[model samples]
Target: MATAAVDRVEMSEAEWEARQELAACYRVFAMLGWSEMIYNHITLKIPGEDGAFLINPFGLHFSEVTASSLVKIDIDGNKLDDSPYPVNRAGFVQHALFHRHLPDAHCIMHTHTTAGMAVSSLEGGLRATNFYACNFAGQIAYHDFEGVTVRDEEGARLLEHLGNKRVMLLKNHGILVMGKTLPEAFIKHWSLQRACEIQIATMSMGTPIEVTPDVVAVHQRDLHMAQVPGGAGAADFAAMVRLVDKIDTGWRA
Candidate 1:
């Protein structure tokens, strides 16, 4: 396994820990098949640094990402570090908008998974047919596709569409989820993907039974109430990190 180089510039313990956590997140994405080559992005804000964040180097695959290799930048996408790689401009555009505007959104993840893209193309988007889907009943948003999100102006429209919501389905594009922490973001994406997968599978079997709106509301409320501090998502993410370490420790490097 390739070892990560030590950070040449000094970083606080918290900052270093954030880098390691973000790197682990990228590795977990690769292991779970959530990464779309090097296309999509998962970005995290640097702890204690206003408007500063860490993102994967543009040319590296998620599996190849390492703590020391992550690029640090401000909200405007200007590199704050001396990394040889450039930031993916489109990724910076989208993630920067959210990180800048949303105080609670410390981590933002975007995915172009098969199921996510499939559901995004659907007319109704995610259906409230299963428990997984029900969990996002009123908490999801949808942004109309305006082609690739490379234009800086599109960030305003994206944020407008995502108003106060944690999950968003980019119509005819893919999925984006934001959270206060990396584990929260990862768990949200996993749940959203599962919901899409379940929706597609059920639809393939001809007409599917839809859950009643009242029941869906109750399920949503129950989920909100059951969410404890550092819930199952934290445990699941830690376990996945362990699995990744067991297979290849390069991510930590």
Candidate 2:
């Protein structure tokens, strides 16, 4: 497979940094077993560029992705860089639609992990049965599955269902999370995945004890407070990046 030759001269410091962070996100997803072969996508908008973002090459495994190998493309799925791998048009259509509609969503992540898909298939979506799940109370939106997200018109419905929500559950499909920053998105995805895992596990043991709405409200507020400018999620993401480096520093390249 041909690798994209990153021209440092053509990229600004911020863009390069974004590329590295986005690549690290892919590697971390692989590490956590959140990736679905080469199917799911995590996209980061290029700083200072309107409607420009970076996405993984269509055929590369998440673990094999590197900072320099990521493909740069516009919102319309047109490749802006010289790379042999073509962008996944379906993924581009879905992610680009969100990025175009939500200006604050600088980073977007989509996954089809076992737990996530299980929860998506549930009629109630994510439940507030655990602390991890409490954080997403009232912050999640649901979108009905309409086959694969390949058509252009699906974008409008997706955006409509995802109105102002950071996390979305695509019925019988998977989970998608958006964030103002890469770390924020990663942390949210981690929490959402864990919530789904716990939910599924508890369900197998008969009726799960649900957290009361009052307690859930308090916990959600506290979680929100902790995600302020220099919150725990940012710190946790920093530690995660360090762990990724320790596991395989090659992701930086």
Candidate 3:
């Protein structure tokens, strides 16, 4: 019991920063129409020797979240601190499963966007039809549907599909991303959404567009080269927060 108590306190200043970035990601997702009516979730692993994580409250929209409003929870989905808001059971199950298994995954972001959902229903899933789509080749995993995902048993199946991959295509559902930090996860989320939008637009045009394997490789190389280092998703988060601050700093209140 003492060991368990010690584990919860492992959160350091760095972990606190991760929390802030994770919170900002939620607000950005809400602003961009990626969130599904407070149904989707973005979670961050708190920095500590013991396992701890942060997730948004169940009732609040992503845009309505502040850093302090985020809830701290254990891998078992138990709340660690006092919070006025409750967590969505489905969201908790999705996030806790990943945090419990993936040591490298510090942040997990999931969404149910119109384009993403449309692509999930397709038989092809995310095809290697374009450079953006190709970026996730061999890196994306898929999980079959199992109802609303509120039960603990569903978590094992979800983790099995996720395996060691960083991105997941929740078939007939939505998109999921995991990374070492919020920036990595957010960038991946943006990429997946953009790819989905492109696929939908192209399919609507009724024209054949294709990319060769050689071109795909080149694009993959460029994508890696374009990747930035550091947990600076916080910088982008701070910028977004500043923008929101101008409109309504009620979040800070």
Q: Identify the leading candidate in terms of lDDT.
A: 1
- Which digits, one per residue and each the tens of the lDDT, describe model 1 over residues 1-253? 3433445567877778898999999999999998887789999998889999999998889999999889989998898887778889889999998998899999999999999999999999998888789988888899998898899988788888888898999999999999888998888999999999999999999887899999987787678567656753787799889999987887766
TM-scores of the candidates are: 0.95, 0.95, 0.87
TM-score: model 2 vs. ground truth? 0.95
Question: Where is the poorest 10-residue window by lDDT in model 2?
Answer: 1-10
Q: Give candidate 2 misplaced runs (Cα > 4 Å).
A: 1-3, 224-232
Q: Which ten residues in a row have the lowest lDDT in candidate 3?
A: 1-10
Name the lDDT value of residue 71 in candidate 3.
84
Q: Tens-digit lDDT track for model 2 on 82-199?
A: 7678888778989998888899899999989999999999989888888899888889999999999899988888888888788999999999999998888888899999999999
- Candidate 1 vs candidate 2: the lDDT winner is 1
lDDT score of model 1? 0.88
Could you tell me which residue pairs clash in candidate 1? 4-253
Task: List, residue by residue over 1-253, the lDDT tens digit for candidate 3.
Answer: 0001113254577656756666667767877778777688888987863678888887778777776778888888788876667878888887888888888888898888998888888887987776678888678899998788788888778877877888998999988888887777877888788888998888888863777778877888776456445553545555666776676554432
Between candidates 2 and 3, name the one with more favorable TM-score. Answer: 2
